[model samples]
Target: MATMITDECINCGACEPECPNTAIYQGGVEYDGLDGAKHAALSNDFFYIVPEKCTECVGFFDHEACAAVCPVDCCVPDPNIPESEEVLMTRARQLHPEQAFPEDYPSRFKAGAAAPAASAAPAAAAAPAAPVAAAPAGGATFVQSPLDALADTVPALESWDVPLTCFRCRGEFEVPFQFIKPGTVLHCPHCAGSFVPNTILYRDVAKRVTKFYDSFTAGLDAIRSRHQAEIERFEDQLRQSLQKLKDDVKEASADAALAGAPQKNRGFFG
Candidate 1:
């Protein structure tokens, strides 16, 4: 059976990107399938899942990714959409042909049991166990080696104190560099404006600085794309307002020109 989002969803939007099939959609958003088919919003107030596209991650993972990451645990199996493992696997194959699934891939109907290890050879079994380097028979205390002690002295990553400025209220704050990560959203305490901190790298620890920056920028881009429709609407409204202002100005200028024109001599005198 395909997974469904329940009414208890808080619309946190954490499950949308985790789906391998892109079956999840935000509230009131139209969904477009890979086959160029469009579907209307299932829910106008809560996040909804497209049952047709949901395969419950049968061929991809042992468990459904949406349910795994949902903070509210609202992504549950749909009782109305009762589909067998075979049907789900077939759909998964159809959706992602490039990824191949084994015949016994873990599914609702299949038990995900590990295959038994092969038996050891008789000759190998007959071989004696290797001798062990034993500690002194006495209750000897173990002492740390020089290299082991040196390993403990390795320096930790130094954290940089970065200053955060609120975009709305212009309030200043300080946060540890480690607190600034990819996709981390912050809110201003004063203005309550949402802000996503930039990825800061004081030192190249684990060579992940560049990767973190790229991921952070990508998340910001995704956020921008998600609200692009709303942005375009605002832009359209601005354009209309500008046009109306221009029209009003033109009418006022025409009225002034007429009012300022000298009237001809009275017709009665002529």
Candidate 2:
């Protein structure tokens, strides 16, 4: 099993140098593979592990060096990504081809502790990703990781701001996705006039937002069956990314807050 770091990490940098494979990295920092290729940081806030380079200390130590050194015990086996001793040893051999590993190399697996069905991650889970938010350990709340990619998938998901134009003053402004709803009112900053954003453009934007939310939810589901640990971390990022889209629909739909539509401007209001 590949070890992963959870959000419980204190950024103490305890696990960075412990890996024999040199797979550990600081949050927000990019990782440089031996092949001279540069990938974006897997995490921007806490320390992270590169599953590609993680052999669970096979052929090197009887236990995971990172887990041994972590102060907070954030390092743990990734159940979502199960790996057998053979696969781990093979990875160790490939990573350090100079050294020869005996068939009975030191490993965390007692025997065939895990099954290797896919290469680290499945094709859907292995698509090239951009830097995205990395979730901490556990299914707990999400913290920010700058452009960090985790959970073996898409880099951090991006955020979108809704644009609006005041009907009365014709002044343009933007609304957050969370605040956009059927009955939400767009108040003109320039003239203090207000109107309901139920126009054709508003409907179009709402549709796109719905589509985005739908696809994103689907992507999150795709992140499953990869690695249990990675799934948690991936969920961290997914929740953190959607934090802004918090269902403020109830608040936004309370059109009574505006009392009634514009009495004069009549902009986009019914």
Candidate 3:
């Protein structure tokens, strides 16, 4: 079954670029499919996944990339759009023909089962027996939030925070959201360095900026084309008017000359 975005979505836009089939779209944006069919926005207030294009990461990844990266875990299986593994795999193949899936590629039921549990057995045995170190004297004890504690226990939860390196000081920091605007500059608390957010720099924000520029240039080109056509039409009309005025002047001059010649003949006869 395809994945869906819940209303709890922060509209951070992290899910859009992670989609292999380009199924995710920002609020109010229209999208077109490879088959030349256009789709309207599903939600005007949050990012939404296109049900037709979403394959739940089948033939691509072991798990859904959007779900893996969402800070609030808003991406979930769509209960309304129930689909079988075969249907999802067919859609994946249709969306990406050049890409090939291995026989063991993940499905909704068998996803992540390919990985052996033998390695985790040793870690699980050592986890409970491991002793927690006591805080040093006069040192304050730090408390962790539920999310942070969960991330510590499960390594997979670490995907929620994306690491970003400061361009000025090279200090590394983690941001909760992956999708940030390119124009948004962030100041590093450690080094006081101001730089653009790197999470969406090459992916979402750059693509959005490029699309806006392309659209703006297209609009300008259309206006210029229309103005040029209008100018050419006006020039043609002015040339026709000048020609007509010249012809009228010539006709009047001819009539005046003919009338004077007859008077001259009369004067000569008298």
* Maximum-lDDT candidate: 2
lDDT, model 1, position 234: 96
RMSD of each: 25.5, 26.3, 23.7
- Tell me the tens digit of each residue's lDDT in model 3 across 57-145: 87777677777655456677777888887898999999888877888877545734332111111111111211123344676666754
Give the local distance difference test score of model 1. 0.65
Span of ten consecutive residues with least summed lDDT in model 3: 117-126
Write candidate 2's Cα lDDT for 83-134 as tens digits. 8878888899999999987767777665653322122221231332323444
Model 1 ranges off by over 4 Å = 112-270
Candidate 2 runs further than 4 Å off:
111-270
Candidates 2 and 3 compared: the better one by TM-score is 3
Candidate that scores best on TM-score = 3
Q: Where does candidate 1 have its weakest 10-residue lDDT segment?
A: 116-125
lDDT (CA) for every model shown? Answer: 0.65, 0.66, 0.64
Clashing pairs in 3: none
lDDT of 1 by residue, 1-270 (tens): 678887656666868988888999999999987669787898899889888898887777777887765544567777788888789888989888898778777654556633211112111112221122235457788675443343334222224345678878999876555666666777777788887754443333213433333333333334445467677999999999999999999998876747559876788868
